[model samples]
Target: MMGRTRMIGGLTAIMMILAMCAGCGIGGDGAHDAVQKLMDAVVAGDVSGVKNLYTLSVEPKMPTILTGAKLKQPIQNVTVGESEKVSDSERTVPVSYSLNGKKTAGSFKVKQDADKNWVIQNPPVFGQVSFDPDLTIGGKPSTKDNKFALPIGVYEVNMVSDVLEGSWTVPVKASSGFDYQGITANKNRKKIKLTDKIKTYNGSMSSLIDSFNLLPMCRKLKELYLNGDDFAFISGKSISSACKYQTTDIQIKVTDYTPDGDRDGYYPIKFDATVKMIAPVFTDSGENDDVWTCQSVQGGRQCAKFVEQSFELKDWDGLVSQSNGNVYYRLADPDQNVGELADVIYAGHGVD
Candidate 1:
């Protein structure tokens, strides 16, 4: 009877030990399955499925920025290796897959949630990547905390600030750790000088200036000046009857070139321009024909009366292209300060 009791006790102990081992095995297998499911979801582009597999502790709710994100290379032939137990509820599972016809290996940190369901702790993704509030990733605004996330791929990062603005591309890899050092605006930027040769959409600066017709602008200003409220009381003194205006000898010399504060591929230019304005005096002939003739002034008829005006002009809001040390002027808002002049000379000749 004693031997039989001893045997029964040994059997009970063995059974208990087997039960505990089985529980551990189940936990490890569950973690492995969870990792496999995550890769499957990524391959299928199932965002919701991917979200469901992440650990509950993840912040910002997995970041919707990954909604349309994609892997640089589609994963194929995924093989989930054995899970290394970390604790009763946590495990690390090794995973291997084919990417772009090449074998790639990675791991997933998995743990059980409150309900004992396996979920990924360290997902093979990037998230909570911080940047300036005016920065954008892949052309989309960042989430709260100036953070964003993306799948394993290359992305275009851009930032707009008062100090500087620029764009660059970055690669986000799986399980590489989120050590993004943020973005810098100095990439691909080069300092330019006013003497640097520049090309515009129309052509060279000289050609662009040559194409501009200053007669219309001059005439409009002269008309406005002559028809001012001070002269409103003057009758039969139309612009055509008073003085004829003409523009000649227009020239431009660029003084400075500056980049836009908020964007790349844009520049503001300042220049000095000299133009000759001629106003020929006209007198009414005392005949019913109403013909007008040039009148003598200062003992000289058809007086070679002309005013050479020098103007300071700037196009501070222009789009200029820079490539391989060559600059191209795109478009700009001409800002000229020709105070009290008959007309304003537009900088860049309104090169839009």
Candidate 2:
């Protein structure tokens, strides 16, 4: 019985020693290994591997923003120093590495969770700014800071909140054309304001009538009067200055609006209008012997005859309305989906 007791005591002592060694391997050495693995994952641009070493609570939420620009730099060397225990469950590991031909220093923390598994409490430190087409703006390479104020023009902006993982594109255009009205964006995202240029009828009776040129027509009549063979020469029986053609009661209506893709702020519209004008004509009296002449009486003078004519003008393309009130035509930008406004303010907006 005494011999059996001694053997049991010896076995218990050996088991305790083995347990101490196992604890040290998992708690101290394991933490140091976790820190090294984190740095290796960053250098390799392995976001999944990096997350695997993080605490379960933080792993899913970890952002790959640091990998945005750093992944392009190759990791030349990495040296990890001894870990210092903060408590029974946590440790800090010191690190130094060469990246992209430059030396850098940083630190991280590792901890043993309730299950006694080693995980990175803090990941390797790195800062990055990732952009589309490899961080360039206005055909120039971008600086470390991500913000940019580009000149007003058309641009295809590449966007990536975390460059290492994936990216999307943003098409931005700002100019005097009728298409792009405004734009909104942040560090890695952007939005373009869409609008449509609509054609409207804003002309008045007076404005439409003023567009007619009657001077040329009047000159043609003067030529007819000078031909004495056609007209009789009589005292006070000639074309008088008082004889004039006049337009009255002009009615206009706009039925529909259509967009033309080729022009800016100019579109086609359907229009209908009634035009009434006085026609000054020399009466052909059929008295072959008597030449054409004006008639005059004491109280009133009636020279040439006066005739009233009414006509309708309708067209699909000939008529147009102004989108910008300052002009006489309508215009639109095909690239932008914007609603119609009286005056399209297109020149000053930009993306930040």
Candidate with maximal lDDT? 1
Off by over 4 Å in 1: 1-28, 56-64, 70-72, 75-78, 96-106, 127-146, 154-170, 174-178, 181-352
lDDT of 2 by residue, 1-352 (tens): 9999999999999999877554245353777777777767755656567657775333333222322222324355778777777787877777887644467676667778788877775453422223333333323444454333222112334221111111333332212212222222223321211112222334455644544322233333443344322234434444433245555646666566543322222335555667676646443342222233353322333345445566565542323322212224221231121211101111111111
The C-alpha local distance difference test score for the whole of candidate 2 amounts to 0.43
RMSD of each: 12.0, 18.8
Note the Cα lDDT for every prediction shown. 0.50, 0.43
Q: What value does the lDDT take at residue 319 in candidate 1?
A: 42
Tens-digit lDDT string for candidate 1 (210-282)? 3233324444434343233323333333333444444444445555556542236355665444545454322
Model 2, stretches more than 4 Å misplaced?
A: 1-14, 21-28, 55-70, 130-352
What TM-score does prediction 1 earn? 0.41
